[model samples]
Target: MKTTLSVLVENHPGVLSRVAGLFSRRGFNIDSLAVGTTENPEISRMTIVVDGDEYIVEQVKKQLNKLVDVIKVSKIIPEESVSRELVLIKVDAEPQVRSEIIHIAEIFRANIVDVSRKSMIIELTGDKDKVSAFEELLKPFGIKELVRTGVIAVNRGNKTIKIEEDE
Candidate 1:
């Protein structure tokens, strides 16, 4: 099964390397990783997607919690949270095909961030399945390139897994 892990770590050099190394040493392959600053600059949030069984994933989380720089970790599954991803796609669009592509983009609620004589760049933000569906629809149009910010998630409403200061 696929699991999304949200890790809060000290905003210090080598922390990311150490966490990544731990996964590598354990032979765990991370499908996607996105790290960014949180509301508190002293901490950084990393969202990682990994494929593993429930028991294996629990073990991985336990191992992660053992790291000094790792403040906290939580596995966000669909039943417990809301997850989303962002993607940008550039597709070939001549005059004749531009309108068609735009129409499809509109149907997906994707924004056309850039348009040129021969190409259009679209920005889409939604859950993984929606993004994937949009990409599949555009496949026949000849995608020039694409980029994605992997899955990020939070528990519904007021619930959250926040790291507490180590005393």
Candidate 2:
């Protein structure tokens, strides 16, 4: 199973390294990780996705909580959270095929962020499935380059992650 953990930690130097080191030492592979400062600059949120069974995930959570910089760790329930990933794909585009590619991008609501005589850079943001489908459709065009910002997510509705003292 793939588990997503939203971890809150102090925005201090080496904090990301410590967290990543912990995962490395435990031999747990992180499928995706996205980190950025939260509304409060002093804090940051890390959205990490890992593949493991329930027991493994529980153990990982406990370990994460022990880190000095860590403030909170919440397991995101897929149905209750909204998640997104951004991808930029550069595909081969000859003049004859440029219009065809543009039409395909329109169908997926993706943007042609850049264009040249030989290629076009398409940017798309959506759920994993949507992104994957878009990539598959563009493969025939020859993907020259691709970059992705790993999944970032938050709970839907009134639920939110807050420091223990705040709640």
Candidate 3:
């Protein structure tokens, strides 16, 4: 099972390193990690994905909560959360095949962020499956390079992970 954790931590220097080191010391490999400042500048949210069964997920949550800089940690219910990832792909796009590449990018609704004489950079954002499918479709065009932002997620509807100081 793949478990995703939404961790809130103090937005200070070396905080990321500490969290990563903790996971490494425990021999747990993180599949994906995305970190960004929250609405409050002093806090940051880390979306961490790891493959593990129920017991492992619980252990990870407990360990994260024990870290000094960590404020709160909660498991995100996949079905109840909305997740997204952004990918930028630079594809081989000679003039002769440029339009064909544009057509493919259009089908995926990806943005042509950059265009040059030889190649074009396309930006796409979606869940893991959509991103994977888009990458597969462009493989034949010969990918020059690509970068992806790991998954970031939040709960749907009225639910959320709120940290009450009093509690």
Per-candidate Cα lDDT values, in order, are: 0.91, 0.95, 0.93
Could you tell which candidate, 2 or 3, scores higher by lDDT?
2
lDDT of 1: 0.91
Candidate 2 local lDDT, 1-167, one digit each (tens) = 89999999999999999999999999888999999999999999999998899888998899999998999999999999999999999999999999999999999999999999999999999999999999999999899999999999999999999896854
All candidates: TM-score? 0.95, 0.97, 0.96
lDDT of 2: 0.95
Residue pairs in candidate 1 whose N, alpha carbon or C atoms collide under 3 angstroms? none
Off by over 4 Å in 2: none
**Weakest 10 consecutive residues, lDDT, candidate 1?**
157-166
Model 2 TM: 0.97
User: What TM-score does candidate 1 reach?
Assistant: 0.95
Question: In model 3, which runs have C-alpha deviations exceeding 4 angstroms?
Answer: none
- TM-score of decoy 3: 0.96
**Model 2: how far residue 77 lies from native, Å:** 0.6
